[model samples]
Target chain A: MKRLRVDRWTGQLLLARPGACPASTPRTALRPAAASRCAAVRTRSTRAMPEIPTDEDYADGTDHTRFPPLEKLPPRATSLPSPPPERALQSAKLAALHARLSLPEKLPLQTLARALVDNSADENPLFNNTNLAFVGQSLIHYHVAEWLMCRYPRLPMEILYAAMKGYAGPAALHHVARSWGLEHAAAPGGEVDPGLLQFSLHKPGNAIVTLGYKRAEAEGLQKYKWRHGISSRVVFDDDFGQVVETDKATQLRRADTEYGNEYTRSLAEKAYANCARAVVGAIYAHAGREPAKAFIRSHILSRTLDLSALFSFKKPTRELALLCAREDFEFPIARLLSETGRLSRTPVFVVGIFSGKDKLGEAAGPSLEVARNKAAMNALKSWYLYSPGEHVRVPSDMLAEDAQPWTPAYIDMGEIIGR
Target chain B: MEAVVTRPALSCCRRAASSAPSSTRLLLNSSLPSGTRQKSTAARTRRALNIPPHPSFLHPNKTPESVASRPTSDEIIFNPPSSAPSVFHTPFKFLPKTDPRRMANLTSNLFASSTTIQYNYSPSSAASPSAETTTTPSPESFPSIEGPPVLKPRHHLTPQDIEQMRRLREQDPVTNSVQNLARQFQCSKLFVLMCCQAPKEHQQKIKEQEEKVKARWGPRRRAAREERHRRMEMLFNGQL
Candidate 1:
């Protein structure tokens, strides 16, 4: 039989001489014999297996390596040149002084003072409203700017960015722009040329509304990029002032009804007054600040306004409407109309689901009262869809087999764009 | 002294009468509350199981009453159950004394011997040796058998890669169970796992229709798609 011999220490087997038997070497061969004998005996007298060296062994080796033999090194302390005694003493003194100052408690306050002073020099964009616009005509720009300043006096540019982006609307944009102007715009651009006004009002950031028209304009002259901030790209020519006022008035007129009862009459007037003020606040802030840029942004990109306060007003209006409808109150629609005023004059846009014959509705007149009466007549047919029992569905012709579904679109303007 | 001597004598007499063979046992029964004597007899049987026999306590007669009175016969006297077992019953037969009193004795003994050994070769006069060794280190010296080495994590590992690898392994558990594969890949078990794939069940479920999407777009889209496809085929055939 062929046999292999192993070096016991390495656990490696080696070829054995043809004539050699098991006990060829005392050290190597004896280990296996002893191991075999231990297995065979199976008694308490059996010796334990030898341990294998592990990573810890190398760690111990490295630990001992810390102390090198002095004989192997050039005797620098005795033979090599050393620093002069005076210099050494000076260095030791300096090092001691440094060590003493390095403690956290011992740090100098001047460093802290410098950091604080350096931060204030930065340009704060929250103060600049040249790029924002509100949705109201009567709103004095200063009032909106003042409210924004009071509401968020010390907000950083990043926070302002988030608020504007998150709420993106004509109302919110107007508030931001007014605040921005009160804070940033030291000088206003030249007069609004008729051509520039027309072009800019249709651009994003220029006209703040529910459905911004600037984005859909043919020329697309306005850029949508830095409706954000600090893009040295172009000076803005926003026209949210004109576009929003025209479209918004149309929406209000379509939803309003005549207020007959004393209570219903009073609330509708107040809601209208409050909304008008909020719209004015939203618009003037954007107009007064960076009217050009702000107008274009509101009018064009994101097709939204800085009308944050409008949402707050709408909340109560919606609740009151629903409450009046559920209780079958005598003049619920009248109450809604009273607060809303003539829908055409209402500063904010009111949207509802589209159903029934006409796909669009709008109205216009000299006063909001006259305009809203005409618009409400247009929107009345679909009011039942929002009522308790009416079933609402998208028109069969409007459904797409393979496309993302969107919210139903409707118009409240007294103007009938398409029958 | 007389009381002690009479007590033993009485006990011996009791043991002798009780230990008589059965025939004589019945005749010699002393009626001094023999029921109590029966109880004492039972106790003696228990003590025999515990203690080795002592010659002085063994009775001549093996009757129950005589067995009760012998000092060894007093083993028949019932003792209350102990809260802890006797040291003799414990598994550690050769355990060192642990009682505070015994420990004090051992410590004093060690101190006395060590002091003597030192003094035998010293020239100092007498004083308490305990005062001198009070300065030595205590028995709690060895640090809680050094705990296993702790491992710190390497923070430089790429988080994105790790997350991706984890998702991959989670998706393929059947093939990824091998530990060696994880080691070869140098990734954690979670990192080796793959994420769940899109469920076939979702595909099988039917969705309810509300408004058809075409109303949102327009019927012109069909014509648009056909025109685009026709253009594509024409280009593919090198005719466009």
Candidate 2:
């Protein structure tokens, strides 16, 4: 939102040494890269190396383009799996993207360029968006969670998780990134524009696990029908309320995983989603809290996802009855509102659920049972999807300048526990 | 409207003509000239959703101006392809609150074919999410084919009454069917069915009757029903 500053987002990445990036504690030690030799400095010594201790550049055989914009590159710059950090300053596509996003003028092109590089493209954390994406993921998760809880206070835990995934999950964020009109390079190379999202479909990205804890039986959680409740999911699983796939087991399987499969589509989605998170991370890292929240609000939160469409009731009438019993409401009784063509083919019946005089919901169906089920579902949706208001104040609103003193949002007791 | 569009359409086409990659080269991911945005054209040997290219893809990408050229006719009205959304019509719910689009949507009902022929898609409904575009758009949640329902929801059934009703229905399910029991107890047929599980013979009888009814259905009606069933399945799985 501010005018361009000379030393903004670039301060962090600009200071980063080319050869001596932090190789500390890799999740990639298990997954082998086909181009592992390009980033030889990493595969050789992740632990042995100190950060920026030496200025020695790892050299491979190929010549790389350097100065004057026409010269063939030398080995030092081109040999690395991804482009040199200095290249970010000169990239036209990177500059175009920054302008397109209307990103804070404080956010530098170099950090934005770094955000384009997936960890799979370049194992070096300095080159890739891992650190930035980690920060962005947390910020995004926090903002989305607070907004959902505040806006729709009575959402069932199951539905809440579903809503979270619909808003902030990799799939949703993938669409967000796509909407920004970003283009991805075929492969990661110094020759490619820094503006293009660079990733290797052949290799699984070592996306840094930031939000969730790794459970002991994480492998068994997905397999063997191991049932974990919503509370445990909050504590142990990822922010999307799914089992955290940060375990070594998933990573090991991911190594042999080829591109263009169903699994790899999720992998591509993760790559694009992390790219989005990296941009948000870059913003927060530069412009502080308020601008990042503003960006998320204008972009991600503004997308349309009908929350009512997410509900999948096994037995809606039963669930509505249970809900009424829990809330100390009057007993629910379905009444026939209307009917048509009763003696003819394709008869229609209209049913409504009532708790005393209050009409909970209504629907029309081909039969009495179907109509009643639909009405019950509608009533439950109106109950579960209750909103305080469209612009309800989330907890983060308190962090704004000249903000009102905290007025607590409505606290829902919880979803009905039913048999 | 067509005159307004031709100018912008020419400029957009010029951009496409000036420096566009050959169709084969675009797919091959041949080393593109630097700064020329060759989008995610690489490594897409396989895709989960093999979406067909838009009919308009053969031509240059249409600007908003080009969309204005869409013809209006009194006799034979034009509708956008179901797969593709019309550029002129954006559902009010999707637009950001600060968008300049709100003013335009409110002033004109884009769905209206011409000045003489206004579709039920009123400008009021297009401007707000609560517009009465469909039968069940708030106020009248439960709708009938003819008109809004005259009957209202009420609650008077007791637990003891429900218990007695259940016993009587269970005793002679054939004689005390759901519809008969509902009339006797002054409750909905759903309540009668909910309280007492229908006996196997009754359920079998209903299933056979449904099959007999289904047998009379034309191919088009049967296909529609099957499509609906599949849609519900997909909706429950949250794929929709």
In terms of lDDT, the best-performing candidate is 2
Candidate 1 on A45-116: residue-level lDDT in tens? 222331222333223332223332111111122221221111111122222322432312222221111111
lDDT of each: 0.29, 0.67
The positional error of residue A162 in candidate 2, measured at the CA in angstroms, is 1.2
Deviation in angstroms for B40 in model 1?
69
At residue A141, give the lDDT of candidate 2: 84
* RMSD to truth, every model: 48.5, 20.5
- Where is the poorest 10-residue window by lDDT in model 1 chain B? B85-94
lDDT of 1 by residue, B1-240 (tens): 011224555576568677878766565455433323332354656755575444223432335555445555335532343221111111111112332333443444333112111112121311223222323222232121112422222444476755654565456544544353355456443334332232344323312122344446566886897886775444322232
| Model 2 bad stretches (over 4 Å) | A1-75, A246-259, B1-240
